[model samples]
Target: MHIEDLAVPSVNMVRWGAPKQWLFVTPEQENVRAFEEKCRETFPWRKQARRPQRAATHCSQFVRHANVLVTTEALLDWGIDFSETICREGELVVTLPGTYHQVVNMGENLAEAVNVMWGNCGQVQSTYVCCSRDGCGHTGGVSQEDLTPEVASQ
Candidate 1:
């Protein structure tokens, strides 16, 4: 439900324990809109709020509490194309910019992640603009504090 840093790529290395299942959705406008609508329907309170926080897009908590998986087939029906992968112990996973992704650990897991900025300045600047417009707290090096209404309005 959330994207990694928009200007950087994230590398994840699983050192031990069980495998991790990852689901990714491309950052297409239609796909993101469909997923957001699904989230609002699943969590009705999100639709009731005047200005719901974007954190609601994080579906891991919902899946854990509701004990329901948002299946790939359902997403496909909603016109969302996705990619799935399983990363086992000692395996590495790399996520590129602008891709929304979710991860579920099959069991206990030990993993480490690092973000690397390798894009040109223009590309980085473009991501900053896109993230800012999208109100994406995790992207373009934006910190949570920067997303506050007061700060965001400035």
Candidate 2:
């Protein structure tokens, strides 16, 4: 459940993976809130850790729960509109900025991805916290002190 770099689009080529499932959702506040709520409900243990929301990266709890595969019925119940696709071998998947996405490999497979920034890139790099390339250390994006239940709720 993360957005790729705002300045770059992620291009993934499925060289061997067949039937890879890709899910995407447009970044909307209501959708994000619903997703976070679902995550919290799914993994109640994480509530004690007091970790800040790190939607930009596949962090611990979220990564574990991502395998649960939210059903289409649940998405509709939550009012979350999404798009999905199945990529097979020799297929290419392109992901644009500001779109939250998740991928599930149906079986063991190999794939490669690269990020490219072009003239049409819209958002500034600083708009979203990128913990992948930047030297943000292990603590994804937000600090622990910055996110309380109250702040996270808002």
Candidate 3:
């Protein structure tokens, strides 16, 4: 799917809005650790900087108390590219921590997605019980016992 830059940052994985799901990124595409160091060296993310290398925060919260949406140019200046990109069928998409990006479907389609969160962030745990479908949270609120994979397998 083709991702057009909406000049905003958001997560749209495994989505069914308007058509299909979408995913999106930058920073020399370095390894997670190097990228985190790069961000610390390049920008003053401060509080947000402390998030894990694989961690990602919305543009609104990427900066501390900025209270303003982040601009593509602003991200670009920090050596993070915010250009429009495409994800072919079955290809995996990943977004970097603290970078701003957009994801949109080019046509009607079907796909799956997963989310990884850094343990350091605030409320690292989900408030609601997760869906039995592994990695597909936010949809199920089963009791803790039923949410377990063993019970799900049975």
Judging by TM-score against the true structure, name the best candidate.
1
Candidate 3: stretches off by over 4 Å? 1-81, 118-154
Over 4 Å off, model 1:
28-30, 37-44, 47-70, 121-154
TM-score of each: 0.59, 0.59, 0.30
For residues 10-82, what per-residue lDDT tens digits would candidate 3 score against the true structure? 2334343234332224524363234344444545544333433312232222322222333456455655444
Flag regions of model 2 displaced more than 4 Å: 27-71, 130-154
Instruction: Indicate the residue-level lDDT of 37 in model 2.
Output: 72
TM-score of 2: 0.59
What's the true lDDT of residue 48 in model 2? 32
The count of backbone overlaps in candidate 3 is 0
lDDT of each: 0.60, 0.60, 0.38
Candidate number that wins on lDDT, 1 or 3: 1
The superposed Cα distance between candidate 3 and the true structure at residue 93, in angstroms, equals: 0.8
lDDT string for model 1 (1-154, tens) is: 4555433468898899999998887667787667756755775654323324334334322222222446788778877778999999999998876566778889998999886555331144222322233333334576644533345346
How many steric overlaps does candidate 2 have? 0
Please, what's the RMSD in Å of model 2?
9.2
lDDT per residue as tens, model 2, 1-154: 5555433568887788556899877557687667757666665554333334444234423423243556667667777778899988889998886566778888978899887555545434343433332332233566543433344345
The candidate 3 region of ten consecutive residues with least summed lDDT is: 1-10
